[model samples]
Target: MIRRSRWVACAGPFLFPWGEAGSRRVYGLVASLAAAGYDVVVAGGGPEPLTTTALPGIDGPGSVSHIGLSEKPPPDAGPLASSIQTLLRWGQRTVRWLDAQPTRPSHVLVHGGQAQYMFHLQRWCRRNRVPLIVDVVDWFNGRHVRGGYLGPLHASMKLALHHYYPRCDGIIAISSYLENHYRRTDKPILRVPPTLDVKNLTVDARQTVDDSSPLRLVYAGNPHGNRKDLLGTVIEAVGHIQREGASVELRVYGPTLDDVRHLFDGRPLPDGVRCLGRLPQAQVAGALQEADFSVLVRRPERAADAGFSTKFCESLASGTPVIANLTSDMGRYLRPNLEGLVCRDHSLAEVTEAFRTAARLSGAQRSLMRQAARSQALESFDYRAYAEPLGSFFRNWD
Candidate 1:
């Protein structure tokens, strides 16, 4: 049997663009392990093995080592091509790449979606007797979660995942909802919410902005599926605000804006509507600073219900107030009268009224609400709290 060591983590295809929360969380997890005196080796998919961390060529002040997987199939390749390539070439390349590493991990951390490729890695770790820890962020049946492509084969893949989960040393669920669902399997699982690096982030004073203006609203997230409904609500609400002769402006950031514009099909955004496209993470805080409130208007669905999006936490940390629709997990965390306003219905009038009320609040009043949002971020969603529990979860495998 292989002896235990103090290393953990397996880098997934989701490594680059470290600006995103999930990517950053993965890096943070490895970095935290390194800080705890564990030797960390992150094997991931990229153009090449990363010589530095995800700050685009620059490494952070962390002890973790990163290796990006270069030989994997390009992301844009269609299904059959990618599958053939992964099965024929990428798996061997990944194994060979891990073999070339100077050290192996005592505990392996594997994220979902990539579970199909993991059997090979699992078998390899079994031969080495390394303990495996799998983290599941979404329901295996929920293909729409995180924009996972769900073709006909998705069902079979999910079945494979169900079988795979029981063999792991431990499992991580990011929400109580997910934990409850997975409990049916009788596996050892932990529900740790998506956490933010709250120390590096601070609740900045709501910058001296034109509060007299109609509420400036910002929405950020992928623009697909039911996300379209949320965007439509924002647009209609902004129209109502304008009809009321208020100076409301709505700014959107994400890949879905272009598709939305196509849906508009040449109808111009009256005046205050702007599609900012997807901005870099560094610029998002500034964008948030400029806005009166952030928006997360997800529709009621299994996927949205089970997972809490990172956008919710980041907006709070940036000191931007949020205006979320009453659906999914919003009711659980955000009180309707406190923290921020929750539109309990899909009516455009209700959403517009909330925007108007946000506009009417005094600077101090809004600041208090923003503070409440930030406090929630620090106390519950901060990464530091999850680190010890998660680290111990891995360590117990010894």
Candidate 2:
């Protein structure tokens, strides 16, 4: 039986209902916490505060209270002056919100990005005897240039890594790479992937394939920052197979043909690849459901391993197997032939061979792969599956 627990307050990172990766990740996490029997109240950066909002993509099968941290602009202030004032306001408001809680939180999960947020939460947790867990999503150590406009922000984040995280009672990481990077002997850590709603990703398994039709492979992200997906290598491999008369078509999303050309430094996309303009999230789900496979190859690097891929998990959930190369902890889950083709490395030859195998999958084989993909998504990415694990992770502290 799941033991009912006190509240887990998530503070300052993703904007609830709609934010980027951080928002999406926190949604899955709090939902899992709720499933594990912890009452969760999440705060996001939004235009206004709400008592409750629709749980995005995953949750407690209902809404949760949300607090917005967007402060009124410091009018008549210069750039530096305005930033300082705005940040101060956000910090003050965050502490006030936390203090205003009906009861003190039993546990707190806060992203370690904003120092003002961290300092206040640390003080609060220390005072209340509540455990504070740092949500370690992205590491800024290697990704940035360290000399640009983001220099100070980057330094601040790095300082948090060396200072705040090590002092925290526990670490909740998004990948094995991050878990390992932030792991300490004194603290416990759990690695969770960016999760999705398995029901939304459900696609009817295809019973038959038209032999004459080209194999459809969807690449649904901007190529500008591939996180080492090796877009050039992926396109080249597909183009080579096309030149050999293989019947395969690549649909590129999130970038128009012109945008593609511009992003690729005036280079044209290979003949077999078609640039499909960006679509709404719901529309993208439809596109993923219709595809034979999704291309998710990434090179071995800190950027690739440090963060898990939300797109990859979504594809599997949509019953579209990924033509993936193991970079992060993907090797932990990807079952070759059962899920999708796996490349041994990022070389052109290896990628070409992976594509060649994908093109050769028979209709029945594709159907089985589709079923297996969804099954993996449910087992690996769904929040419900992690309830027990999350429960255990916290129970030890008590």
Candidate 3:
């Protein structure tokens, strides 16, 4: 029997195998590490049961432990308070759990957390002489907070980041924007973006475009306050395209029709627009494979600059091109007319023109673009490619 290395991954409070992009990234990392012959224990807080079926591709599901810290808090608690309390409890339980293990972990990997709890974890790791690698997935500053009521909380969190990030043993950034922002003394900073299990994503060889068939466009994600304006802009742009006599159909998943209506202030949906409620991963993958293009946009803000979109990677892996605005490090990977169309200003006219350009592409051109999209995924976003680098990094800590 092969002796496997053990690792403990501390992620935020989320049900395993959920639709949230950050949770999916954590799952992918755990599964990849397990596949690479590491015994990974995912510790977090959630009510959902974590079963073998929840982790489909992982080997020895019994070896991978799921340690739940506490039940999710009710909605009455403010967002900042809830996050702080959850991380506090999770950090406490995680330290106790580590003490009970027969052997200490080779290293500890923390995905995201509150500043105080993360600092506490850092101190514990230092005392135990264990390597602690922090993954920076988002800017934890005030940009994510919607109203001005949480200004003080956001400011304190920002202060925490200033003190917390520089003390970690190593840092893993998800985008160039974050890489540039969090460059403290010469610690090992790896740019590991959102990764996809490319082997599982079945690529369609058949062309999605048919001159006679209406252009099929798909968008899947939640409509948070930060994302609402961009989503509304896309919807209005779709309406413009339809009115110009373009046979385009936009199918939106992850938000109900009523939700979208509410975003539009109860305005009726235009023709060729359909809102399908949240879907399972398998169904969303199928929709992407069958669509001509996927649409994504982010406004110019600190929050937008700090992270990359996982939907963009999924779309490309499904052999579908994208129509996205240039934000963060997205331009580094996607090129206009090669992988997909890009909107420069994200203005209504620019987005509408992008849709028109995509609609005008010939069948052969679209097929090549789809191939390029898949190639990009295989080259840059595959999770298997990350395993070796991450494993080597942990091993060298000794």
Tell me, by TM-score, which candidate is best: 3
Output the worst ten-in-a-row residue range by lDDT, candidate 2: 55-64
Q: 218, model 2: CA deviation in Å? A: 1.0
Whichever of 1 and 2 has more lDDT, that candidate is 2
lDDT by residue (tens digit), candidate 3, 276-306: 8889877778889878899987777776778
Q: What is candidate 2's lDDT per residue for 1-398, written digit by digit as tens?
A: 11234777778744546445567777677777776767677766555656665544543432345667653343455877756744454455666776776677778888644565576778888987889888877656444434443565666666677787778889988888888877654688888888756755546656666656678889887655443456667778888898888988888888678866654557766786888788767677689877899997777777678878888888888888898888788887788998888889888899899988878878878888888888898888887787678878877666
RMSD, every candidate, angstroms: 4.0, 3.7, 3.4
- Candidate 1 is scored at a TM of 0.85
C-alpha root-mean-square deviation, candidate 2 = 3.7
Candidate number with the higher TM-score (2 or 3): 3
- Please give each candidate's TM-score: 0.85, 0.87, 0.88
- Kindly report which residue pairs in candidate 3 clash with one another: none
Task: Report every candidate's CA lDDT.
Answer: 0.65, 0.73, 0.73
Q: After superposition, which runs of candidate 3 have C-alpha atoms over 4 Å from their true positions?
A: 1-6, 47-64, 74-84, 87-90, 141-143, 146-156, 226-229
Which residues of candidate 2, in runs, are more than 4 Å off? 1-5, 54-63, 71-78, 85-90, 112-116, 141-150, 225-228, 396-398
* lDDT against true structure, model 3: 0.73
- The list of candidate 1 runs beyond 4 A from truth reads 1-4, 35-37, 50-62, 75-80, 87-91, 140-153, 206-211, 225-229, 256-258, 326-328, 346-349
